[model samples]
Target: MKNNLYNFTDKSGSFISFSAHRIKSLYLPLCNEILMSSITADLHGDIKSGQNSFLMEPASRADLSLSKSSRNFWVYVNKDQVWSAAGVSKNI
Candidate 1:
């Protein structure tokens, strides 16, 4: 089965999209949380690489946790919300 495609949008009406293959190549174990973290890291790296600020706004609570690492920037959607993480990636 083909992996799901993910889209990232900024507040300035600009957006970039990526396929699961692209994500997998960058980050091992393409699980949802890992993918989200990968996306945030990639985005942050892109911004830092360009010497610009990185900003992310996840549409849902599930998408927000990827940025939780101390190495990454974290922006939570809500304090009382919770989400069950999905399956782990089998292909390492």
Candidate 2:
């Protein structure tokens, strides 16, 4: 959990930081949210993943439909309007 495959850090090693608290409290939850939501779609027979994902967009936290055009990807949507959250898949 200390290291991640995803480039959550800056290459120049400046202007950004992945503190242990951030990774555990923020980053990991986001990645997990994608998995949770994908599970929701998969239950209905639509598999979503990196290969079938979307670019992050300012979509409704509860918005449905993952789209793509020769470059499919899931949008990293926020979980709620009042406060940003993860584990939104449970709502779907």
Per-model TM-score versus the true fold: 0.20, 0.15
Q: CA lDDT, every prediction?
A: 0.34, 0.32
Q: Residue by residue across 14-86, what tens digits does model 1's lDDT show?
A: 5454553344224322234223223332332111112132343422323433443323333333675433222
Best by TM-score: 1
**Quick one: best lDDT, which candidate?**
1
lDDT tens digits by residue: candidate 2, 2-32? 4452344567743343343332212211245
State the displacement of the C-alpha of residue 69, model 2, in Å, after optimal TM-score superposition.
8.1
* Model 2, C-alpha of 50: deviation from truth (Å): 16
